[model samples]
Target: RQIRSRFIDEVDSGVVRTETGATITQKADRFSLDESSSPKKSTSATSIEYDWETPVSGKTYKSASGSTIEYDLQDGDDPFQVGVIVEHAKFGPGKIISRTGLGMDAKVVVFFKSRGQKKLMLKAAPLQVIG
Candidate 1:
């Protein structure tokens, strides 16, 4: 109160500002922020979705974010049996230990070098024979 009357009121007579006990008001009807305003979020991966291409080995697809996401597709040739070595698109190298079912329902247990061991479907599991 004392500072406003002594300091502010002395130098505040140009635009004519009114000060009341409850309020000190100034008119700003000419204020505009349209030129400085913009969207909070810019064009991003989530806002502008990426249409991924069909994943295949030796082929690469770039995302909207500019990074190439590696899509390990499930593709392989069946030469599966016990003691057969194979390379998976995702799990790296593994050896076939056992199998179950046949053809489309075929599933095999494989011991992976990095992922320990897991069972994979023959028709769906992405594998390539290395050995």
Candidate 2:
């Protein structure tokens, strides 16, 4: 006895083979080969803006009420504790709402009067305690 084989192409399916008394089926490639279907590039540059304000380190300024405010960067005091009133040149007066971590890796969150809330480093933050 002799066996014959042939290939069959279906619209919905992939390659099919028929050999004498047996049939085999395969799935077609689902990916596209055309370059026109590729993604397009934008003509304009993408713009990104940050909402957080950067405080100047070791800077001093006078408040609107005629009081001189200065940030002592070298002060070896843990003034960034919670519930402490701190003043910044850019964010004005703010209260330390929360403190996280410890030592050099510590961070504090301050709720300012006009600048909302800001997260700053504890040791290097530009903040001065208001008595």
Candidate 3:
């Protein structure tokens, strides 16, 4: 006596096998296939929002009547210029004492009242008018 083996492909069910004159069927799992299709990923959107207003020069920095912003602080060693007023969403209101960059791409070394002197990049566009 001789035994034969064969494999069969099932479209809806899965696969079928034949060994030693015996037939066996396998069922397909829907969840196992779908689990890999869905992926967990982080959203690429800005969560913080900022408001703009006129600055009162020597007045105390506050959220109201001024611009509010936030920074990722993810790029380079630092960003910001010293001796120049800058808008740091993370450090709030401050001035830049030095700058670092070549031509069009320069960052500021700002001295914030809250965070002291630190480096932060300057985002283009004016948020408020400071006297």
Candidate 4:
């Protein structure tokens, strides 16, 4: 009777460790095409800009890097509501963990737990609150 959610799948990286704690690695088929490593070139030179503002909430968001973002519930919410999208200068995007007066904390927290992810700022960062 439960509807499975995609959010659960996004939680961890697919890599798994054995009981001995030795690393396990997987390989995918390798194929090379000329376009595989090619850079995408935009035909149009027009600039696209979006100024997001909420009249009721009085929230504003703007980013120049145009990085992809995602969000999760703010800990206590039920039915898994979406929270704020926390962007970083170097650590990329992550889910907001807790909220404070200044801003919210986010943890990238991948299964592999990259060094950068551990060092990623989990306390104060600019956030875009959404439903």
For model 2 the local lDDT of residue 30 reads 33
Flag regions of model 3 displaced more than 4 Å. 1-82, 123-131
lDDT of 3 at 99: 76
TM-score per prediction, in order, is: 0.40, 0.40, 0.30, 0.20
Model 2 lDDT-worst window of ten: 36-45
Error of 4 at 66 (Å): 19
Rank ordering of all candidates by TM-score, starting from the highest? 1, 2, 3, 4
Q: Model 1: per-residue lDDT, tens digit, 33-127?
A: 23232233222325652232332344454534454534344455336767899998889999999988644446899999899999987656767
Error of 4 at 68 (Å): 21
Summarize candidate 4's per-residue lDDT along 20-53 as a digit string, tens digits: 3333333343211233221322112254322222
Reference-based lDDT, residue 101, model 4: 27
Q: Which parts of model 1 have CA positions greater than 4 angstroms off?
A: 1-78
Candidate 2: C-alpha lDDT: 0.58
lDDT of each: 0.58, 0.58, 0.41, 0.32
Better of 2 and 3 by lDDT: 2
Cand. 2 TM to true fold: 0.40
lDDT of 2 at 74: 46
**Could you tell me the lDDT of residue 117 within candidate 2?**
95
